[model samples]
Target: MRTAICDMLGIELPLLAFSHCRDVVAAVTNAGGFGVLGAVTHTPEQLEHELAWIDEQVGGKPYGVDIIVPEKYEGQGEALSLDDLAARIPPEHHAFVDRLLREHGIDTTDRAELAGRGMNISDRIGERLLDVVFRHPVKLVANALGVPPRYMIDRARAEGVSVAALVGAKEHALRQVEAGVDILVAQGTEAGGHCGEVTTMVLVPEVVEAVKDVREVPVLAAGGIVTGRQMAAAIALGAAGAWTGSVWLTTEEAETAPYTVRKMVAATSRDTVRSRGRTGKPSRQLASAWTRAWDGPDSPGTLPLPLQSLVSEPALRHLDTLAEKGDRGAQELATYWVGQGVGLMNRVRPAKDVVYEIAEDFAEAAERLTGAIGD
Candidate 1:
């Protein structure tokens, strides 16, 4: 627990739990680990309200925020709203989605009404989220998709808030370090959302070696890292901590869609597949009919970032609802972004209990390693 990440975040444990649920965030923080709230989906006003609620619950424990500001996304600077993006989605793609849904015996009626109701990815929106975060007492801010924007880096530095960024490769980590990120989340392809095809064991040390001297930023090994021994391995390879997301989805307080959580609990490491059906980027999700469609040869290629997300958002929402109703095909296509670590997550536990479990595993692993050296 005396790792650099613990020192940097002012937490007793270096385990970082990322969740969209306020209860999960507060519980992890109060349990002596850092909890980072995913802020990409929340509007600025909603984030402000959620952060305020978290502040009241955690009683001043340190926490962080994560936003998805993809360095290269559709409508990057166009100032497009969700409606604008929805309009840009080609009619061909829409037709294809409709055909697929109906062919699979799923409903498509709600897709039209929900078309443009979600968050629109843009530099402006990300900056707005940053402004809301800076107004509060956040300890850290992370860019989930790419290097922290220069403006974000400048703002966080000015406010003394540490900035972290996720990278899927060694080169990406170097880019983040050069851009002034305070921490490197070396995420592997096995990660759930918008990831590249590199396993954690290979990616972590590669990133550590790439940035250790050029920048002394702490590296957190992520992707398929589910157990304390895995976290220990990352530390032994020079990482400062572990960045985890999927393991927290099953936590009692997680805000993951209910049906998706049920599927996650029953999933195996092999149950996931990487496809561009969700966010227009290759993200790992539970293998389902949805991913299978994109992976199939007869399917049309995926659209770019926001465009693809726009086209699929309604379908995904409907799938979840229908899947919960025992619709077999909907359930077959019902999945969410989660890492390969699903196999290790068997039961639902409290967020606080998860924090303790990680700490206990880390301690036990360290003790065993030390004893082995003595032996």
Candidate 2:
């Protein structure tokens, strides 16, 4: 609780809950832990609206915003239209998606209409979102993938907002430190969403040790850390706090689709897999018929970031709709981003209760450790 991250963020607990739901964000912050809104899904206007709503809800509690500005994507430098990117998606990929849907008894007739409607995750959009974020009283701004852009870092510094970067490897951690990130989220493969191959147990200490000489930025251990016991373990491994996502998905205030939330509550850690089927980057998600279809031997390989998203998001969105309507096939195919820690998330509780539980459990874990040392 006395970690540097707590002091820097002005939070009582170092548990940072990342969620797309503003309710969860405000609830966690009011519960004494920091809440960071996942802003990748929001456009500038949407982000502004959400932040305003969060500001009113939290009543002056400090919160953070996370945006995805990946280090690499299909359109890294050159400007490309959504039509251009959609055109580049191989016909085979489309056929595979169409076939996958039809086989599941879901209609794919309006697939094209749904393809590019989702939020575009690019530097251009990120900058616009950042513009909106800087005008607000955000305590932290984090880049979910790759290094935070120099402009973002500089702008956050100028705004007196701390910048954080999520990294899966020690090398990436060092690069972020060199890039002047104020906080490092050492995310392991067990994490949901885009993640690298290393496990948290190994990657956390490796990153902490590797970044010791480069800079002393606060390291938050992420990936499959859903409880205070896990948070205590992360601290034992040299993390200042725990950066959690999956556990929040099951919280009462979470905006996770109802069907998906049911699936998550029923899932075990082994029920998740790391597949590039969703975001075109290796991210741990609930292992479902959808992921299995993409991982099968007959499947076409995945495309990169935005391209992969274009193909998958629309289809998944439709599947979710059908699943909600009680389509068994859609239910089997319904999956969402979640980590291996989902097994422990067996029930839905209020977001505030979750924070208090983590704090209480973390205190007990610390006491047990002290007892072990004969203190």
Candidate 3:
């Protein structure tokens, strides 16, 4: 299980769990893997509070933080208020969302009230959150959508923290290394959340070979890596570790909506789709009525980045609430970001059990591989 990443991050297992839920992060970290908190959705105050709570739970175990600062978006570099961002979304898009919900017999009375509460997709907001993150004792800070902002890199270095970036292509990996990132997460399209159209099997090695001459940076294979066998495969492909997100969604400590978790547990690998309906960026999520409605031929086209969030988040939030209340239509429409590996995640286990099981499986896989090679 030893690798350069383990040495750098001071973690036992090379598995890095990314989750929005602090409980999942702490549980994984406590169980011997590195836990990275997805802080893109948290406000500065919320991030500060969550980090403090995680610090208390992990008892000095190393952890990381992930923030999204997309390279391109609707209002890049603008200091627009949430209300201003919401105003930029077209009225037709709003109508289209309402029509979709009504067609499914879901009520949308409080939909307007739910707007403007989406995750921060702007660099400006990310910087503010970074201010809060550097104040904490986090061992790593990651930028998910694009290169890490210069301020983020400089601040992390000043605070003695490592900087990581997620990339979907070899060129992106090279760009990150040239930008001085300490770690690169080669995330394939099968990954949940915003991703490009490259498969993990191809992207991992491509990135590894591409970045070797640039610098000896650690590459963590991500996207659809749920099992220890997959982790082993990633290592065989020249990855130093695995950066996982989807598997944690079905864990007992996950903050995923109850209805969404049920859907993920029952889902097959073929049951997901990469669509821009959710985030205006291609993210692999459960293929539900919601995604279908947006992707259908008659639907209005999606917006870009934060603008698309303005259109989708309110409706999705309402659907989650209704689904929780046992509305059949809402339940059918309930979906969350998950990788193709979800087909294998059929049960809800504790986060610690997941970490231990993955470690054991990885060991067994390695033993089998070694045994295959004759003396």
Top model number, TM-score: 3
Question: In model 3, which range of ten residues has the least summed lDDT?
Answer: 107-116
**How well does model 3 score by local distance difference test?**
0.90
Error of 1 at 106 (Å): 2.3
lDDT of 1 by residue, 1-375 (tens): 589998999998788888888888889899988889998778999999999999998888999999888888877777777777777777888888788878888666764544644435765888899889998889999886777678999999999999999999888888888989999899998887778898988998899888878969999988888778878888998889998889989988886778888888888899998888887778988888888887788677888877887777767887777878888887777788898999888889998888778878888898999999998
Specify the poorest-scoring 10-residue window by lDDT in model 1. Answer: 111-120
Q: Give the local distance difference test score of model 2.
A: 0.90
lDDT of 2 by residue, 57-129 (tens): 8888899999988877887777776777778889998899899888988777875545654437654877889
What is the number of backbone collisions in each predicted candidate, taken in the order shown?
Answer: 0, 0, 0
TM-score of every candidate relative to the true structure: 0.96, 0.97, 0.98
The better candidate by TM-score, 1 or 3, is 3
Residue 52 lDDT in model 1? 95
Model 1, global lDDT:
0.85
Off by over 4 Å in 3: 112-116
Candidate 1's C-alpha runs over 4 A off are: 110-119
Greater-lDDT candidate between 1 and 3: 3
lDDT of 2 at 23: 94
Residue-by-residue lDDT tens digits, candidate 3, 1-375: 599999999999999999999999999999999999998778999999999999999999999999988778787778787777888989999999888888889766764555657767765788889888887789999987788778888888888999999999998898899899999999999998888999999999999999999899999999999999999999999999999999999999998988898899999999999999988888999999989988999779999888887788877878888898999888888888898999999999999999999999999999999999956
